[model samples]
Target: MPMLKYLIIILNDASVSFCHYESAKTGKKEAGMISYDNLNKAVAFALKNNLKVNFLYPRFRPGKKYEKLIEDVEHVKIVPRKLGGVYSDAITVLEAGDLRKENKVTGTENIILRLSSPELKILPAAVKEIARKGGRINLVIKDVENFGDSKISEYRKLLAEISGLLIKKSGENSIPEVNFLTDRLMLESMNNCDAGITHLTVAPDGRLYLCPAFYYESGENSIGEIRNEINIKNRQLLELKYSPVCRICDAYQCRRCVFLNWKLTGELNTPSRQQCRMSHAEREASGNMLEELKKKNFKGAKGIEIKKLGYDDPFEIAVKNRYSIQEFKNFNS
Candidate 1:
């Protein structure tokens, strides 16, 4: 049975896609938006299946017909900051270009700061400012695979600094939610993006995809069409528990992005060194932050603990143990 919890409707071909995988190479074409007929069908699908809709917007204002179609559904609007109405939506995603604008952090119940590694190093103050306004911050690093040694060090130091900032900003009583660092502290099980498992994307082509990146990167690779049923071949592979390394790993906050996995390792279940190491660093940072929060006697944070691990990458440990993927299945079983 397909547990389709989210219906990610891409309004146009040029809609703002995911921050990391959607590079300049995947620029806009003149292909146009999803047909109003397809939009209505998708919305009907969401309503019939009880799935929440997340509408990805284009840079320009949509026409009245399209706007009216969008208004028919109770969906979350995902728009670029320049398009305005960031304050009213359930979530706001910041592209790297959005950071170039003037600092004006006033919007939404949640804000996703999508930055490259270099951008994150200088973004602590901005993150703190955003937190001051009381909206949750989800910091998404676009270029995770390209993190050199210096960049890795900078990431560690930055997390430490931001953890303290969050502590101070929330005072002694509260813990402000910062996805990169603080999310791991509270997560007990894998709280990954769960792309194909819990969510699916519908591109302007009226095709169903695993996620937005799959559609944005290549529409020809669609799993199914909106007019018919969704056909996710070997769909079990998309779940976290089916992942050999991820099932045993305790880095719960890792997005385990299926798109990133397929992009780097040629398999949706297998993760790259960059993903594992960066996630472990954040996990360790969360551990340290949790300890400090406990020391301050913060409620609900007292019993939380992220264990210390020797190796950052789980693949290295598997190699050391001479462990095969099959061994992981048996071990986890």
Candidate 2:
């Protein structure tokens, strides 16, 4: 239950969407939705579970009372640059930027710049700027479900370009690692989105969500009530071992989101087309980055070895009897 070190604390009238995930759905905006009681309880839960809390805030400011409660613990607040001066010391800064605008601010240190794929082309220079800013950028596809075979070629080219930029930057005597490509390069095992396996979300309404995405999509999506008891049916199904494709897939940096799995495959553990493709795209980019970095003699990549696989998606390899999956090996330990 305390497997995840990071827990998102939703503290907003309109929760700020992170670079990679959209939390709130509809146009619901009303500040102070999370009652003080819930705040204290969440804080208590995080302490009891030893999870690091990350708070997502609304566009508007919070009352002093709310601010005091949020500061009681170490946490992260997702806020917009439009609401600048809200907190200079924000644990993680998220910007609501178009692909180009996201590019402009990509260099901010320790910031999450969210952008869609189509917008990426408009700001071809954003990747370079991101390298310049020494920031970590995560590319979030606004409409990942819309991805198709038609886009694969373009996506690969984009990844190659991003890989080139990362390689070029790493040669410049500084670290400007971008999540889409660089993360996988430095990672050895599959680093997937561990939603039900490691962490669970406590919505504003006190229901348990797999992650922030489910809470916003449909309130009917409540898995259970945390206050009552931890009652997620077939909880093992949420773990990686249960996922046929993902367990064997080394596209290790993929989010492998449970919600996206449920949406596409009608199962929590199984991944959808778009999710796998998006992840594989990133994985391939990372692979290329690893090779490019080798060419440039990057040092952080020392002693890290990314396995070479002939296939992009694990599904393909498994379908062809290439390899088997063993899920119990969570390497976080």
Candidate 3:
């Protein structure tokens, strides 16, 4: 079994989501908090496994007891912007609508901006606004599963615009770290959301899930109880080596989200057309940005190159480059 390095403890069923998945609205009356016993067990489990914990919070402040237990270990707090006043040091999550409202950004806070495809137009401006405030933004396209050709084109165009801004910032030596664009430039290998491979989630019921999305989508999809052995069915399918296109492709920073994979392609190892296209758009933009930065003689642009690809979607090339049985085995080896 792969060593589990991180544990995402969902403090409540209504915990604010920080990724592509949607959680119950914070103000919802129906909420389920993780039992104190389960939370204790989870903490113990983390200590035993030497795992880093990330506590996902809801709108309401956790009681002193819960807060005390959380502080017992080193952990990251992921909370909604509304709770920012309470957990001032936490990584904040903001919806697209929230961007219009005045909010305090400490210039050091790592912010996650969750927006849909139609909201892609808001990103370049949002990036500039956040960067001006000295804050870093990581964008999550919440509706990536719905990215058709039209939306993909819009996303690609917006990325080009953002790339131009990033290139300018690079020249000024103030390049802001936007995940999709900058992350790819820095990474040389796949740095995906390896849920079930590198990390797992502890839901309100104290069940182990591949991620919070699996728990929200269906409880039956859970790997096992937190106290028991994690038993992810067809576990190898979750690894990079098992993903044919992903293994060969170089969109290094793509989340390669398994939840989105299972939702859109119905196969954990098979990436959807939407995901491939979206990631490639970002990849192409990153390449352009790198070239611009190199021309400006940016210090960090040395030795990094995102090669241009003939096709935006790896699926196009993957189909023609199918591996034989022995070749597949050797690749995995």
Candidate 4:
């Protein structure tokens, strides 16, 4: 049985689906909200499967009925920062294009900032402001595939600058965690967002998918419908142990988005070069930050070790050493 923990429900077909790949919301608007009957069934399916639901909202407000149905169960709601209230307590997700330094994001406790590669370079000022506001930040790169090895220094510099700003703003208070850099410090093994393995998504069409991206990208992307049994063929592809390179890699904070794997290499188990290198760079930066934090008397990072690696992409090293599938298991053993 799949150890399913979360069910991401895209409330409408038009909901903002931001990540490392292209936007799931295709051009010109269309009526995309799922029928009330379908949504109720979806919620029932979640309860049956013992999975927590997470609703992804679009620009418009859901009707009273939809709202009540969503509130009936314990679930998470992800809405655009521009959507204002209704789901004010929900996790606010912002696209880089939508944020300005002057714009005030009302409730700032847990915020997700989405940025493309180019926007990432110019957003230190905005990030500093967010850091000053005192909340947890998840800096998600929508176009991580564009991140090149040459830009590793820039990425590190940005992380260092953000760390400095966050430390300065907090003064003696506990430093709020930064997802990309600091997450690795606290993790001992691969702690990726196990998309298809540990989580599943329900689309507006009432079909279950590996994730929301799969639903919006193509209806055929769905694994099964709500009324039918939840089916994920060859489910092992979603597990980390099934991945040759990632299984041995120590970059515990890498998202390891399976959708990106399918998008970049047309294989669910393989990862792209950009994904590996960027994750390694973050890993290296986190290691440095861990050492720096230990010096500042942050004992939580004590005894953490992230060895210096010559290759940013583990696949290169594995290939160079002629590592086979059995060799990966032996290395970890």
The most accurate candidate by lDDT is 3
Model 4, 1-333: lDDT tens digits are: 247787888888777664554444542333578778888988887787777988888877787889899987779888876564566578877776667543543465677778877778655666565666667778788876777766666887887777666555533325666788767877877777788777888887877889877776788988887754556798877887677678768999998989888988898888998889889888888777666676676766546688888888999866666657666566431
lDDT (CA) per prediction: 0.76, 0.66, 0.83, 0.75
- By lDDT, the better pick of 1 and 4 is 1
Listed per candidate, the RMSD to the true structure in angstroms reads: 2.9, 3.3, 2.1, 2.8
Candidate 4: misplaced stretches above 4 Å? 21-30, 101-106, 167-173, 322-333
Q: Which portions of model 1 show Cα errors greater than 4 Å?
A: 23-31, 320-333
Which pairs clash in the backbone of model 3? none
Q: List clashing residue pairs in candidate 1.
A: none
Stretches of model 2 off by over 4 angstroms after superposition? 19-32, 91-103, 172-174, 322-333
Tens digit per residue, CA lDDT, model 2, 1-333: 336676676665366776345655433444436777787888777777777777777666667888887787777666655454557766344434433344355324566556565665743465676667666666556666767876766888888876676666675334576666777766777676677657677677756677878877788887776553567779878776666677767776777777777877888878777777777777766766676677677777766666566665667765776342332454222
lDDT string, candidate 1, 1-333, tens digits = 336788899887767655566623342544577887888888888877778889888776667887787777778888766565733654667765665665655555477778887677557766776777776787778888887667878888888898889877655666778888877877777788888778888888787888888876786779887644667799889876677688778898998888888989999999988889889888999888888877777775545678889888888775666556676566521
What local lDDT score does residue 90 receive in model 1, on the 0 to 100 scale?
Answer: 42
Per-residue alpha-carbon lDDT of candidate 3 for residues 74-95, written as tens digits (9 for 90 to 100): 7999988778767666888888
Using TM-score as the measure, the top candidate is 3
Candidate with more favorable, higher lDDT: 3 or 4:
3
